[model samples]
Target chain A: MENPPVTDFATDWDHTDPAWVHDPYPIWDDLRQRCPVAHTDRYGGAWFPATHAGVSAVAQDTEHFTSRTVVLGNGRPLEDAPPAPIGVAPPITSDPPFHTIARRLILPAFAPGPVRALEPRVRELCRRLLDDLGDATEFDAATQYAQFIPPGVIVRMLGFPEADEDMFRDFIHVVLEGVNHPVEERIEEFAPIEAYITAQIEDHRAHPRDDLTSYLLGVEVGGQPLAPEHVFGTIILVLIAGIDTTWSAIGSALWHLASHPDDLARLREDPDLMPIAIEEFLRFYAPVTMARLVKRDVEFLGCPMREDDWVLLGFPAANRDPAVFPDADRFVIDRLENRHLAFGLGIHRCAGSNLARMEMRVALEEFLARYPHVELTDPEAVTWSQGQVRGPRRLPVRVASA
Target chain B: MKVTIDAARCQGHGRCFNLAPDVFGFDELGNGVVLVASPPDDRAERLARLAQVNCPEHAIDIEE
Candidate 1:
């Protein structure tokens, strides 16, 4: 099999660069061609698997690559220490055997029944959030509409206080976007969120209900109850994964439709295209970049990967790989063979994926249903999130009926 | 029509069960457990086909 030329890049790039943050596709395209498996000193030593094949290899080969330290390079996860980091979210930060158990413990919450059962409430929440906008012509789609809907679903699902949606947004922002800040500051920002998760776990232990937290507490993994830290970690993981991930996708879909009137008209004129459009949106504006820590040194696919190396599974980049996707850049709504890795491939594939896609479909369906003709008010003012999961942070649009 | 689910490939995205619950069952972990190994009825054929198509992993296979 022919492969893209691998250019040895000792100093590849950083995620925080403005050039990368504003637009990463050009950079990703460049990497996919020149350095399919590139390395950098960024984050103390990280590897970039920028192709569909490269990413799949890393994500699928958990035996060689571990999830022990996913984000921080060459260090044990915070969950490893005593007091063991409040709400130490698992599955993502764990290796096999254990990750498998954690994954099974939480699967039912996001299964088809739960997600389908939640759809009516999701639709009602979307309707109410849209209703509050009340025909405003110019509004920040991110804050005004996109941000509110997911948190409502999350808040309702997690049994958190209904009014604390903004709190969810703020905490996630710091954790996902505040990579520029020192680890200490980021931990300080995350402390309360973990505490909140811990409190919820405690509450569920005493006042167990039908909620996810209570469910986790009641389940026995490996013939033993899950640790409080694991429970806390899982809840926090669910909250972080649930709330903002799809919010950005929904916001980007709006950005797409608002900018492209023909597509909007097509979707509006024929509602049958909504499902296809949702997948297309996920493929085109694919969000999320996850990482795995190298377990041992192995020359992988012509690249020398060392032990303790951090290899980022470029999920979004893999989605746009030209070798795998024809017209990798174009937004073809009806594309049938869309085997995209917008959700990371392999065992660690997104547990929240079903939920994210469901939310995106419903959000867009109700959105264009309410306001058919929409346009970007200030396209220049549009901004996207910087680190971890990437999407529109601020998208201003003018709706005909709002 | 015959429908087979490769457990090795099925990562439990639940797309199969989501689209056609009648044709697929779920283990406690939400992994796809095909109820009807091979379709004897036309309704099961359609349902299995839909489930196969929706699977993110393409873990489900249909044979005629």
Candidate 2:
């Protein structure tokens, strides 16, 4: 274990800060111009790669930056020590050859086939959720509509009891928001979630079903059954990975729609433009920004990063990079030649990208048809989470029931 | 237009299939599988280009 290199970092930034979460672009814009490879001693000293090229390189270079502790400033024992170290999972924390197997097991669920198969269900869910909002002209889109779809889809996929959704949501919040808690407290909070998942795994063992847990139980890696620890971790990963990530994305997109009626109407008029629009929304309001712990000493984009140091890949910043994307700040729904990194690049790209897109598309289309005149009740009041996933925590949209 | 996919580089983000379903298909493992269904018209040609450009891996190529 080598000591982290101490150096005076140029910028002082913290993701846990609400101001940063509400609007990080201005600060990121400043970083890209002044300090593309900036550093901070806040979280035991971590680097911030603000530029597109810099973040892309950091995310792709698996040899140097490892996905051990993705959460920034994830130190352990409720103290200043770096949090639990390549986490015992196969895909997210595991690198290269090992990641391939774990990713493959979950790939089919998100592939075009399964996603397409779930389309009708998605539409129905959207309609029912909208129905639940009947005669209500004023509502928070975040809770009323956007937040429900992702977790609902996951529950159906995992065969978890729908009644347990509130509990699951609570667990996910604690786990994902654990950055604010001490490592021990975080673990204590997460113990029930782990126990619940364990019971599900054991139940599936006794009565195997077609759900993800049952399937994962039988999955073999390199002809040997994947370890129980890894399976449990993967399930937890799926819960956290699936729920808020997509909801944040969908919330942001709807927020954009509320603010920009022209774009919303255009999408309604030309539904064919949706595929392109979805991509554009993802690029502009990209939700996830994950970090990787440096595995060994390596210099990235001329900045020397040492082992165990955190380097946050600001993927959303990369999408706004003018060098790669012309008119990067503006949201062009039908923008051609748009290759955005809303989902992180390389092997660790979002495992649920397809499902996310499908959910967003269904929600957007159905809402447009039912409530065509959706607009933000108070644009200034919209707030986003200041964490790995970004989305409107409270989005009040005014819609005239038609 | 003829298109090619560099199998080695493809991490299977599946944008190709999502954008241009006619041009690309998915293998069992969810990697994009180039289809024999060629771009037969201008609309398809446009989609093929969109798919190629949006590929996160830059795995697709056009040979018109």
Error of 2 at B1 (Å): 3.9
Candidate 2: the clashing residue pairs are A75-A83, A78-A182, A78-A183
**Candidate 1 has which clashing residue pairs, if any?**
A87-A232, A87-A233, A88-A233, A89-A233
TM-score of chain A of each: 0.93, 0.93
For model 1, residues A1-402, the per-residue Cα lDDT tens digits are: 112222334345676667777898988898888877777766657888778888888888978887765554323435346242222468777777777777877777777668888999989989988889885888898888889888888888877779888899998887777766665666677788777777777777789887777777888866888786787777778877787788888988999999999899899888977876877788888878887777789888687888877788878888889998899999897775676778777687788877887899888888888888899999999999887688888899988853
| lDDT per residue as tens, model 2, A164-209 | 8778777877766657665567778877887888898889889989
The local lDDT score (0 to 100) that residue A12 gets in candidate 1 is 58
TM-score of each: 0.90, 0.93
The DockQ figures for the candidates are 0.40, 0.73
Error of 2 at A362 (Å): 0.6
Clashes per candidate, residues 3 or more apart or on different chains = 4, 3
Q: Docking quality tier of candidate 1?
A: acceptable
- Tens-digit lDDT track for model 1 on B1-64? 7678898888876667755667888776667898878767878788688777656577898888
Query: What TM-score would chain B of candidate 1 score versus the native chain B?
Result: 0.85
